[model samples]
Target: MNFAKILRACKGMQWQLSREYAFKSDLKIKWVRPEKIPCTKPEKSGDLGKLPPVNEKEFLLDYKDSRELQSADPIVQSLFQLGNNRCADTARYLREQLIKEVQRHPLDYGSMEAKLARMTVRIRIMQDELEQYPRNTKLKVALKELIDKRKKFLKYLRRWDYRRFEWMLEKLDLVYKPPPAEFHWITRKESLQKLTDAHCEKIKEERLAEYRNMLDEQKIPFLEDAIKKMEFVRKEQIDLEIPVSVTEEQIKDFKRELEALKSKREVKVDSKK
Candidate 1:
């Protein structure tokens, strides 16, 4: 609401109050009522009414710059944008409250510092939400998380600097949507899938080369040859029996043996020729 509109509304309210009191003129009025009917005068000449116009270009440019902000989930981005105005106002209010709290209880440095940090982070998140998707659903969720997280973080700072908060908000400008086309152009799932596929292919190629080297060097025909080459053979194929009385400790010892085998053994037979 602009200053002029607010004054006009107040005047209308006053007229209504006067009418109501006139009906109850029997009551001894303590204060002097208005002599003439309530009417709003023309707004003062220098009082430029209403908020200054938003700088769409500068705003959009800031929106273009935020890479981290743009990386937000689309749903979340939208929500933030949707709730921007309220989020902005709320953040300012919360920060102001925190400031007052800090001033009121200066000696309680621990609690005051905490609240300051919390309010700062909250303000940052709210500012980000407002910048990106003012009034968006994503903004709402971000705002909530931001509030909760910042509140938890605030338990540390002794003094507050709102400029820091504003700078952080400016850094967040890129979060808003409709974001510049570059961010929205690529789908996360698709990009991840592409990366994973490439990684798998690379690993498969490496494994294939390793196996090929193993086969070529050892002249092993198949996996069975590889396994047989790794086995130790005794002269008479002596039947050695494991102690059936193997205790739990013995089993653990044997388990470590297998692990060592896995680390050190690679079946490679020397060519007879």
Candidate 2:
């Protein structure tokens, strides 16, 4: 036969053999096309380059200076009356007291003592007013603000001069409680330690789980065989020349004998040297 005819005969024979094998075998061959995964669009970046302008009213509400409170608020005049009895006109007396406390060479309004005194007076007046007008939300808010301001001053005083701070608290009849030690900010060391501990714990749990799974996956017969060997060793099979069940006393004695043998061997080696 020609080469092309011979090739056709071989191919036909192979096809027949494949059909016969498919009919006989229980196994079936299948071709599956993979499903396509959908792609998601990337999120657009926000315009973070330009920040919004700060609201002046909101800023003043939170961080108003004592001087700002002086002429603008009648509450300051009332606060002054509660703390002092020097002058009949509360506003004038308040101004005079502030100036005296300041004792600035240039008579500037930015004085630590004067600010603290103002905040103390405000806190006392607010507390009294709040007791009277318990239902007033505005009064309650104002009182909370005054208390916060006073606490800030107290913090400064405690840091700068504890003796002066105590004296001031006594003079004002103010109860001062220090802020909590825990702050919003975290130190690098603390952050690293926390992360390290968490990572180590996670890794340890994962490793333990993996080891447990590995032990579980071992064939039952393999485990049975190992247990049998251990049991045989524990029983001290005479034919195997293995020791019987080892007691605490026997283990201790064995350890001592091993140590003595080690020492004697070392001595013999030294003598040879």
Candidate 3:
């Protein structure tokens, strides 16, 4: 054969493949996928603290501070409180409350507390929306990005002004969960393989225990049969006036072991009953 023929003969050698080239696990087991963490916290009450009072729900605009519609006309006030409070209205109210004490001036929006307060309000609103409509992907993405931005701001605040950072966290009732040093993804194959190994080990232990019990069950019967055989041989030898291989001490030892095994079996049976 020429070199071309030899190459053609070796081309279809699929049977010569080694398992090292492919990712394969010896164990086969099923494992449920872990649930992914959500960007918005629906379970939480809110990051901006508790809800506003029932009576003041409609009048989201600040009546005391802004002096909005300064005249004390009951009809105008009733008109202002006509509709129910929207999320934006609530967020605006909460933002003003958070920034009222911390602001250096009426327009100190650049301050650390003011920035955190804004982010917190938006976060709370988004979380509520997410709870109502969980499948809103665009909102989910926006919330995640906003959360990351807030984390960065919080970290900066912590590094520069730690006292204010502590105050901000307490005021917002927010937990700062820092990102891990490294991120790892969960793979089904690896997880199932680990579970399979553990399952095999458990099965091994169970089967070995059963085999031990089987061996133990046969111990008394084997001892009795051996004692009988030894006695019969000793009797036959004695009748023929020959030397005996089985001694009285050996027979006594077998009888003692048989009695002990029988007592143990009886105890196990009684315990089961």
Model 1, global lDDT: 0.45
Candidate 1 residue-wise lDDT at 76: 52
lDDT of 2: 0.54
lDDT string for model 3 (1-273, tens) is 799988876764553444423424443454789887665663322254644443552564655434655565766666555255455665677677767766769989998788877877777778778878989999989998888889899889889988888887887787776677899888996786688678889999999988987898988789999999989999999999998888999999999999988998899899999
Please list the C-alpha lDDT of all candidates, in the order they appear.
Answer: 0.45, 0.54, 0.75
TM-scores for the candidates: 0.20, 0.30, 0.51
Candidate 1 residue lDDT tens string, 147-223: 44443343222126555444333432211112145654455556655665676688899999899766544442343
Model 3: residues >4 Å from true position, as ranges?
A: 1-30, 42-54, 57-62, 65-73, 82-87, 101-108, 135-138, 193-273
lDDT digits (tens) for residues 7-74 of candidate 2 = 99999999999997775353232324344421110011111121123322221222234566556566
Q: Which stretches of candidate 1 lie over 4 Å from their true place?
A: 1-115, 118-185, 188-203, 209-263, 266-273
Give the higher-lDDT candidate: 1 or 2. Answer: 2
> What's the true lDDT of residue 98 in model 1?
43
When 1 and 2 are scored with TM-score, the better candidate is 2
State how far residue 54 of model 3 sits from its true place (Å): 5.5
